[model samples]
Target: MIHILYDRKPMLPERHKGKLMDNLIGNNLMQRSKKHFSMNRKLPRIPINRRFIAYVGDDFHFVWVLDFNYRYVTLQTTKNHHQLNLLFDAENRVFLDCRLVKTLDEKSRKGSIYLYEIINFEDALECPLSWTRTKSNKFLRKKPRNSYPVKLTG
Candidate 1:
């Protein structure tokens, strides 16, 4: 059996699992990613969805959401120095997943930009630890998984 996660609704039917995510992205009805450069703990707004997603074609890299919301979603990445991403959505269909790439200044950290896709048919949602965002980059203060699993749900 499969299920889809959503607020105010019970588990979605199994058939709707994969198609749900595709529909959301295709219709651009779901969340959005806000990309910007952060300085002095201040987030600067820039063009959203301006960056292209890496390793998508051959490597099939994508965002596996561990948590999700209307404005932001917590997801796992497939590479090192790029563990978790905070996907911020401003306008519909325009979003950015700010991946913390490096520690730059004393107060701000550098983040890589990427296009994110929410994986459908995951598991029940649970709140994780607190995450901070400055500028356009999003990184976890705690250590994220070094490797990705074959299947990511919920």
Candidate 2:
């Protein structure tokens, strides 16, 4: 089964995963991103949902918990219209999976939004490590594969 990640309760069903993420990562980010750019540490975080609002110096704005082991955390920042992303390296204690992407904002009605859908650790690296934006552009062309194996479990 394809399980969708969330901050907590009131989880959306599998069929609504796309809408879930879209609702979770909503607009007003241009201002929120500017406020959290200098955050250097983590903090107590509430569960993520539609009404969640981020404040300045808030670590939760950028740091995302990917799993219970805390093995993966995503650091998503904004630079102008593009997003600067960094996925943590659990063993190294560093943000190694970096990316620069333009998020899809349906309300903006801008030219086709660009993004990099990071499926796994390898795809995460390939996304940002390139000198140019590879996956971001590719997403505009087509969607990337994020399906899990048949027997994988939580």
Candidate 3:
């Protein structure tokens, strides 16, 4: 992987060292790929990048739409209980996931176990792909949660 090789380079050549630039490019590549899914279904193809149309106004804010499909449309209630459909400079800013983890709490003196799914964009992007691979649905969720309906949301 060029990205991997780039990260393992030495410093000293400083600003002109090709490795640092390579790593930056690699990091960007990984960031872009975070939301990619290996969907094999005959669905309308979406572009490679991720973006959303959002509206934000100072006057009113009631609900937000994640996406719409023939079956149903997903809506998210805004923190402020106002009613208005406003579109601001918005993009895919919400994300979610489920993961198994070990923890210690007041109830569990030794340790507690639970699915540690909740995560932010950056952390979610760096997540390993090992668990995503399965014999049945290997194509789903190959990358970070992106898009609507099937995306990761708060």
By TM-score, who's the top model here? Answer: 2
Candidate 2 global Cα RMSD: 25.6
Ranking by TM-score: 2, 1, 3
Against the true structure, what is each candidate's TM-score?
0.19, 0.20, 0.16
* Per-candidate RMSD, Å: 25.6, 25.6, 24.3
In model 3, the worst 10-residue window by lDDT is 45-54
Candidate 2: misplaced stretches above 4 Å? 1-91, 106-114, 117-120, 123-154
How many residue pairs in model 1 have overlapping backbones? 11
Residues 4-71 of candidate 2: C-alpha lDDT, one tens digit per residue: 44545675565654566666566555556775546333433322212111223224243332211122
Per residue, candidate 1 scores C-alpha lDDT tens digits across 36-116 of: 555441322222223233333234344444433323333344343343333233222233434444432232133322232
Local error of candidate 3 at residue 31 (angstroms): 54
Point out where model 1 deviates above 4 Å: 1-60, 69-72, 81-91, 101-154
110: Cα error in model 3, Å = 29
Residues 16-106, candidate 3, lDDT per residue (tens digit)? 5557788889999999989876835343322211122323344433333443221222334323222223221124333232222322122
